[model samples]
Target: MSTPPESRQEAIARLSRSASDLEARTTRQLSHEAAGQKAAGQAWKIIADLFGGVFVGLALGFGIDYFAGTTPVGIIGGVLLGFAVSVWMAWRTAQRLMAEAKQHGEPQSVPFDDDEDQGA
Candidate 1:
């Protein structure tokens, strides 16, 4: 029995489908990677903002204590101020991110659990 010739039309259609699938997969992967990178960058920025505030406060406090000879008072005050600043910075960052999310129509929301207290 003679084998039938391969159909050029079928071959083209198969190639087109394969190309489409590949393109879609590539697009999806790229989007996922981009989103991951963006998230990682944001996290790093948040950490930096918090720690930066604290470290700056610590440095200032140490300087003041060294110069004023007030010892722990300067350091303690500095640390408290630094913590407050850090909290404020974090809040602002969260607000900015939330606004951006809303602008993007994503409107991100995080769920909180208070059940632990009830269980206890």
Candidate 2:
């Protein structure tokens, strides 16, 4: 008897299924990464907002005094204090975040579950 003809259609279908599976897996992984990035972006925005508020307040105070032809004492003082407070808050937040992250840690699998169950 002659050998069977190579089933090109079957081969193509198998490859198509494998490619679809890979694409699905890759999509899931990318979605997970995107979520993490989104969270990080939110955190960054909060930090930026804090810094921006402090800087804006200081600049506004300075502009008011300068345009009004008033003394630089108050303006300079406000700017210096504003910068110092913002920097201190940022540093403290960073420290606390690191500490909490260390304490909460990452998830891990069960090391040694019993294997005598009915199901293999």
Of the candidates shown, which would achieve the greatest TM-score relative to the real structure? 1
Provide the RMSD of all predictions against the true structure, rounded to 1 decimal: 10.2, 9.9
Where is model 2 more than 4 Å wrong at Cα? 1-6, 67-120
Candidate 1, pairs of clashing residues = none
- Residue pairs clashing, model 2: none
Per-residue C-alpha lDDT of model 2 across residues 61-105, encoded as one tens digit per residue: 688788887768657766777777777776777777668778968
Taken over the whole model, the C-alpha lDDT of each candidate is: 0.83, 0.71
lDDT score of model 1? 0.83
Best by lDDT: 1
Candidate 1 lDDT, 1-120, residue by residue in tens = 998877999889999999998898677667767877998898888898899888888888999999999999888889889988998998899899888878889633432346424644
